[model samples]
Target: MAIPKRFEESFADITALATRFGENEAAYLSSKYQEAEVRQDFLDKFWLALGWDIYHQEHPNPYEREVKIEKSVMVGDRGKRADYAFYTAPNFLQARFMAEAKKPSRQLENQYDCFQAMRYGWNSNTPLAVLTDFEQFIVLDSRYKPTVERSLSGILEKFHYTEFGDEEAFRKLYYLFSRESVGNNSLEKYVEGLKKAKGKKTAKAAPAVQIQPVGDTFLSELDVHRENLARAFKRSNNELDGEELTEITQRTLDRLVFIRFLEDKLVEPSDIIDRLGKKSGSPWRDFANEIPRLNQVYNGIIFKPHAILDSPNFAPNNKTFDEVLAWLSHKNSAYDFNSIPIHILGSIYERFLGKTIIVSDKRAKVEEKPEVRKAGGVYYTPEYIVRYIVENTIGKLVEGKTPDEIAKMRFADIACGSGSFLLGIFDYLIKYHVDWYSGGARTLLSARLRSSA
Candidate 1:
């Protein structure tokens, strides 16, 4: 097949850029070249040639743009902005893939660079992402959860700047990432093909590696933390019964998780937990001291002082508290709470709430609560099911209602479990109200009033 005229032009431009870089490699690779310069001069043209509306020229509305620049996403406890996020038109809110750009001086193959890109993709539920510095372009498979230990894994393709001119290489790039191809669902199909091919190849050699979902993995870790905290508390306060121990342990874990979630959402400073983890004094005490202030600011039940748990006598050693903090830290943790949906957290909490700590002979062990066990264990309503139910019921009820009318209606779920149903309803109502406002509801109201007058 012949290369399209647009691609031919892009290839020529890229070749020229490569030649210029080659002539003064040191100068281009130096700090003076700058990331913004490379982005403007090379990357912009590279994507524009792929038929992307890089500047949203065709789509003038900010909300409807196919591409977003410097899109901020939560990664661990802080916000990490992706250099570019590409979307299929009309579904502009959900990104199809992310592209992270760095200066020519930076190596794209490093663990840090690769992991950063992968985390953004994984957290956002994006299947693939690109990491490049114009020096090297890498396509990464981001279906697997990212971890520091597996930072280098999941690299699908790598291309040097010189490869941009090669017909075969350029063709591959076009098929994989071009706006037309992506819009036609070619990228997803290609990823599926690769997975099937890999599965066949690995079938005879070894067992398939089971990739755990982020929510499940986090829930498992939460269980371990709960066990550790429960045992530590039991050892410290033998007078406390199993119920008291469980309440204290669960409350402490809940507060920590809540604060971490806030930090990732940019509502709290990133260092709030990290500073406590690194404190010379008791980390538990320092963390406890921060809760009162947090409660004052947020006025929430999570941070509110618990009569038993918040008492000075209700103390766990610094070591146990520090370990939990270390596990939740950005450097050590795999979770980006901001990207993980609230429903997933609710699901985790639902499961966590079903289990209780039992103390026997000074050892604490986690067991399913009797009610949960009788009910055959905790079950979370899938988000899809919840959404479907909400759409049919709450969605229909608020179809043309104003925000004030919708706000007056109350939603109830007697067996709420994790309150997933309520959350789905809340999400639907919020979107309905926002759409009503954004779609000139006020203009309609003004017209109606004028007609009456």
Candidate 2:
């Protein structure tokens, strides 16, 4: 295939920019040359050359733009901003990939920078992202859950500023990240090819190493929390029986996790749990007190006071409550609940249902239920299968139907385990309605309302 004239022009511009950076490396690396400066001078040009409408020159409408600058994504209680979010045209809402820019002085190879970039991508459910500092460009596989401990593991490719003029390097960059390539599904195909290659390599290895999914790892963490909390509650309140202990422990953890989710979704104030942790009084009590207000707003049974746990006699030590709250609300906590999908949360709950708490020798322990043990183990339906079932069944039912018509139709899953199928149905409906409203229907509705008035 021949290189297009536009690509050649872009290559010349990138080469000139690289030359400028090389000639004044020290000045560019200085504190005076900030991240914004590098982004405007180098990062912008880099993406622009790749055919991204960075400034929306061709697509003036905000919703039609292929790139979003400084898009704010919620991470736990805090909001993190991505420097650039590239998208395929017509799907301007969801980003295809993110680009994080740093000043030339900053090291892109550092764990902090790598983890930050991957975290944004993982949280947003984006599959790929780029981290650059004008001096170095790093491509990251964002499908993996990011952790500061293993920040470098997800990196796919790396290149230095000096390599910008190299034909091979530029071609690799263009093929992977150019807007034309992305629109043509080149990026997806590339990732799929990488996955197949990885699977083949792992299969041929002497001892196959299975890379655990984020959901399984998170479920393990939840099991640990349940065990710890169960033991702590039993130790603190000896009067409680096994059933009471189990209920209280599960309810407490469920409430805490839900609050964290709400915080990340921006439904609740940031760090509501953290603020509760800072209280001199019982943090659990403070949190429990806030539940009523939450229930008033959201009107759900999850926030409702439990019959036994809410009793005055069911008090666990303040120290125990404080520790759990601190573990969740601490700045360095590993879990980012926002990144986890609703189906994954449902899967976790399904597994949780298969376990029970047993009190022996004044100690509480989590154990598999008799039925679950008899059946071998708890089995969760894979996300892909659930999506397929939902689409084939519900998709057909809602075809060519208006939002009101779809709303009137009832969908049911007879053996709904943790409501995964129902969640899939809900997700399909939301997207369907949004697409409908965003299209011609919205204008028609407005006209109808105006005519009636």
Query: Which candidate comes out best when scored by TM-score?
Result: 1
The backbone clash count of each candidate, in order, is 0, 0
C-alpha lDDT of all candidate models, in order = 0.78, 0.76
Model 1 per-residue lDDT at 250:
89
TM-score of 2: 0.73
Worst 10 residues of 2 by lDDT: 205-214
What lDDT is obtained when candidate 2 is compared to the true structure? 0.76
Superposition-based RMSD of candidate 2 using all C-alpha atoms, in angstroms: 6.1
Off by over 4 Å in 2: 1-70, 73-98, 103-109, 121-129, 140-157, 175-211, 317-323, 437-453
Q: Judge candidate 2 at residue 209 and give its lDDT.
A: 28
